[model samples]
Target: MFIDAIGTQHNPATDARIISLVPSITELLFDMGLGGNLVGRTAFCVHPKEQVKQVKSIGGTKQVNLEKVKKLKATHLIVNIDENPKELVEELSKLIPHIVVTHPNKPADNIDLFSLIGNIFDRKGEAARLISELQAAQTQAQLSAMELDEKKVLYFIWKEPWMTIAPETYISQSLKIANMITYPQESDIRYPEIDLETGILDQVDAVLFSSEPFLFKSEHLKEFAQTYKVPADKLHIIDGEMTSWYGSRAIQGLRYLSDFAKGL
Candidate 1:
């Protein structure tokens, strides 16, 4: 048996019919050799591209298609505290027997995540291997971070009105391991809209544009630089998944971060 992020009990199941709402966890399921057991996934669960194509899509994280979910007859449903809407999970719980809620707040949190999903799906051996690999990656990242100067960065996630993440988010913690501290160290909201004219850039050593949620391109740098005081050298586009995806990908992400910090 395993306890989920929400303290729900889940026993090991030989007959696990799983449906995942979180993309990272969905990818982790495949890595744990439980891809055959996954019957449904959200539309955003696109990693392991070819294999995930086999799993039927219920819908996106928030707007889940209950009708399609019913047809799949999934015994276990996976959700995330930040990604999946609470009401949606509550509604699905009436039909699905087990709801495994995940909330991986930092890079290291993936350790518990591996044990939680792996043990429940009877893939304890695979989970142990992943845990070992992730730990080794952490050690390597720390060594790399030691050689570089710690930087304060303002990471952009969206651009319509221009949004940035708070320090407490998973993305922030992931970057922190690379010795990149997210600015606005504190915020009233998790994701806050910022004004370019307000001079937040002055406080940050670098300004990063994430390549997801809102695809930040090189062109954005030239356009924004034309108006703002940001230096071209201080701005770079980062692979959003490496910082956001907390799963088997995190092992690779740690390596990516270590490499990314060395170039800085």
Candidate 2:
């Protein structure tokens, strides 16, 4: 039996009608050759686009469609602590037989994540292959990071309030692999709103804008440059999935971060 994030011991799932609420994990499931078992997924689970389209959509991560979930008759529900809400998961647990809770705090956490999902659904060989590939990518990322200078950076996830990720987040850990240290050094909040007037610009070497959740573009950089003395060249819009997403995508994320940092 494999243990989940919530300490739930799971027996090998057979003929499992799986529903994935976590987006990245949906992709991971497909990678582990369990596409035949997936009965439902959230709207945001868009990776392996052509493959996931065949799977039914329940709803968003937080606002799940309970009626549709029940109709799907999924035996296994895959969720994440950070991406999924507790109350919704609790409600779903009443209907679904197994609630496989996952919490991958860092990039390397994919090792256990891959193993958990694969072993439970009998995809051990595929999981081992992915882990080996991820290890090679990690080495490449390390080499790339060593070539670049370590930098303190401010990563913008939201615009109106100017929200940034905390040091303890997966995004911050991914950036750390690229030799990028996220500032504000706070841990209580995952994403904290920043006040530019507080002289926060003086603390960071560069600022990054994420593409997902918020579609940050060069226009925002131009607007910010008008207000702050920081050079426009130092501000960049990054691929949010490559930095924020975990699971199988994290392999590509690590490589992407390496290339992005090298360009800076």
Candidate 3:
């Protein structure tokens, strides 16, 4: 028996039919050589493109098709705390035999998640290898961060409401590993909504625009340069997957952070 992030009990079975709503975990399953057992996945699980083509779509994370999931007879349903709403998880738990919910906030959290999933899928060796690789990458990222000068940055996710990553988010943790300090560190909210006129920009050395969730493009940077007093060179477009996803993708993310840190 194993407990998930939400303390849900699960009896790990070697022949469990899995349905993954978390894109990162979906990719992790494929990397673990369990892609054949993956009966269903969310449309967002685009990594391992060729493998995803064979997996059945279970709709989006929040709005999953319960009937379709039931038809597949999934023995394990994987979800994420940040991706799936509480009500949805609660509703699915009653129907699904094993609902594994994961919420990884940092590199250590990701390691634990990998171990848990490895145990669930009966692929301990593969999981260990992935964890080892991630640990090494994490160590390299931290080392590179120490060599770089401290840089204050504002990381933006959404544009319309002007959302930014707070200290509590995984992206903020990645930013710390990249030797970048996020502005307005006093916010209790994980992802806060604020405007540029709030004087937050004055404290930032740079602004990092994510290429996801809101799809911040090059044109937006030009518009921001015209509006704000910050240097145009300080604005950078970063891959959101490298900072946001917390699974096997984290190894690549940490590597990207290590390179970014050395350049700064």
Candidate 4:
């Protein structure tokens, strides 16, 4: 029996018909050599873009087509704490026998998730190798970060409401590995909504615009630069997946952050 991140108890199925709602986990599943085992995935689970076509799409992360999921006849389901809603998980619990929910707040958490998924899917060797590589990559990032000068950065996730990634977030922890410091100093809220009128630019060295959830283009950057009176050179568009997604993607993410840190 395996206890998921949400404390759900389940016995691993001999032939797990996995349905993945979390996009990152879908990518992780494919990376862990479990793509052949996937029965269904969300429309948004587009990573390993070519492989997604082979899997059936249920719906989005927040709202999945339960009827469609039922039709797929999945034995196991994969989800995330932040990406998936509780009620949806509860509803799916009745339909799917084994539901594994993962919440990775750091690189270590990701390794644990790999191990858990690997054991459940009987891919222990592959999971061990993945964890080792991720740990090695993270160590390299830490070493690289030691050499780089720390830059005070504000990472934006949403533009409409203007929210910044909080210090407690996984992305912020990942940024620390790259010698990038996120702002405001302390906030219990995960993604705090910001007020541009408050003049936050004075405290930040740079403004990082995310490419996911909210696509921040050059025009938005120009607008922000004008509003904050920040120079254009201090603005950059970051791949959100590299900064946020935790899974096999984090291996590539750490490498990207390392290079991103080097450039800074």
Candidate 5:
């Protein structure tokens, strides 16, 4: 069978040894009922903790131990487009079958990507189920969010330089579907650096801090709240997976967003 990007084919039924380089794709593999086939995973693929415990970790997505990967005899090596360097993928391409999963920063792009992954892994039925579920969840989130008249919110991914989600990003789309507006909705950059002196924070109704890249905790939220003079209740520390990962993990995102809407 032909897979996207990575031009490698093997008997889907017999290709039992697999290595996942991306956390989202690893979660998808598990969701597709291929958890038993996973032989190795990156250190970052920590979902389904039990399954993760069973697999050997090569390293992080950007710094995989190629020697260890080769020694593991992995039949398939799945890498994310942005997470793994292209040179490394090219090098690994010569050793084993590699599948490159392009990161979809927008919700719209995710449609075809999900279908492609399903087709590649011969899990079309599960993919369809997941797609249907996501579509339904999106609809529910939209409807629930529409009922609220909350002000525009700003979502920060990093703290040091203050990086935020852009208008066309997946997180922005999810927030929009949930009826929440982003502060800089027209910015073309998917992840842009924000200027603290720009008075942009004054326009936002709430600030959401994600737990990734920069792990924001209650103390971090308190600092922002004190600095901006915004209420502590306005700062929400959200799960990064819910706002980011565009796979089966999104099934959980819908539920979390729905609950967030109810709270609003």
Candidate 6:
């Protein structure tokens, strides 16, 4: 029954009381029609507003209320490897069955992860439906965007020290499918600090700043534009989840990216 190195037991038939530590996973649970089984969720999980309001908030991904989590007596605790610390996982694992899902930041790999979640929740039909929808939307977005002629774009995740989506990252792959070229396409690191002055930023047709990892507001974008002397319209602040989170919600990303491209 053990799934991986973490000693997570698989119970595809059980309708256990579940708590989700990551927002993306929480959304997945709801998407799979298992929302009724969710007893607790982190504050960061605000996808379906109704579910967010109903579930008890243990805390954010980085900081969890262990006492509250323990008291909830959840049969299954779902966590993301990148969200929680190892020590916390170990501590929680001792108290209850903890399922640690490794974050998949690549476009194709995300499909595999979703399938895995489907198996865990015993909702393969729902998962397959979502995957088909995503694939169809992705195809449509790609076809429509291609008519405009692909534009070179840079997706920024952080600003204090500029960091962008690196090559092989999910965002980068998604951008490529949307017919947008990303700068620094050779780096394998998911997120990397970029040199703005080395002709890298100059070659891009536009720059997209994410509202997470570092919330990039209009002021921040203006500052960046002024500092870089780029056009104001070229700088955009995008929803972080639409660009970063690759899960059941990714089907929504294709539509979001399609709309964003219309603006550009």
Span of ten consecutive residues with least summed lDDT in model 2: 183-192
**Deviation in angstroms for 59 in model 1?**
0.9
lDDT of each: 0.91, 0.91, 0.86, 0.87, 0.77, 0.77
Candidate 4 stretches greater than 4 Å from native: none
Candidate 6 segments exceeding 4 Å error: 1-9
Clashes of 6: 0
Per-residue lDDT of model 2, residues 1-264, tens digit only: 999998999999868999999889999989888999999998999989899999999899998888998899989999999888899999999999999999888888889998998899999899899899888998899888888999999999998888999998999999999999998887588988888898878888889999988999888889988878688887989999999889999999998999899888
Candidate 4, pairs of clashing residues: none
Worst 10 contiguous positions by lDDT, candidate 1: 221-230
List, residue by residue over 176-232, the lDDT tens digit for candidate 5: 767778878778676888887888778887888889868899999888888878888
List the candidate 3 regions with Cα displacement exceeding 4 Å: none
Report how far residue 46 has shifted in candidate 6, in Å: 0.7
Error of 6 at 142 (Å): 2.8
Per-prediction TM-score to the true structure, in the order listed: 0.97, 0.97, 0.95, 0.96, 0.88, 0.88
- What TM-score should be assigned to candidate 6? 0.88
Relative to the unseen true structure, what is the C-alpha lDDT of residue 240 in candidate 6, on a scale of 0 to 100? 82
Give one digit per residue, the lDDT tens place, for model 4 in 13-109.
5578999988999999898889989999988889899988999999898898878988989989888888888999899999998778898888668
Minimum summed lDDT over a 10-residue window in model 5 is located at 5-14
Q: Tell me the deviation in Å of residue 170 in model 2.
A: 0.5
Pairs of colliding residues, candidate 2: none
Per-residue lDDT tens digits for candidate 1, residues 1-264, read: 689998899998878999999999999999999999999999999999999999999999898888999999999999999898899999999989999999998989999999998889888899999999999999989888888899999999998799999999999999999999998888988889988777789988889999988999999988877778578998988999998999999999999988887776
lDDT of 6 by residue, 162-214 (tens): 89977677777777777777887778566788888788778888888888878
How good is model 4 by TM-score?
A: 0.96
Off by over 4 Å in 1: none
Best candidate, lDDT: 1
> Across residues 1-264, which tens digit of lDDT does each residue of candidate 3 receive?
777887877666899899898998899999998998899999999999998989999899889888987799878888888888889878877777887889888766888888888888898899899989998998988888778899998989998789998887888888788788887686878888977898888788788899877899999999998877677888888888898988899999999977765655
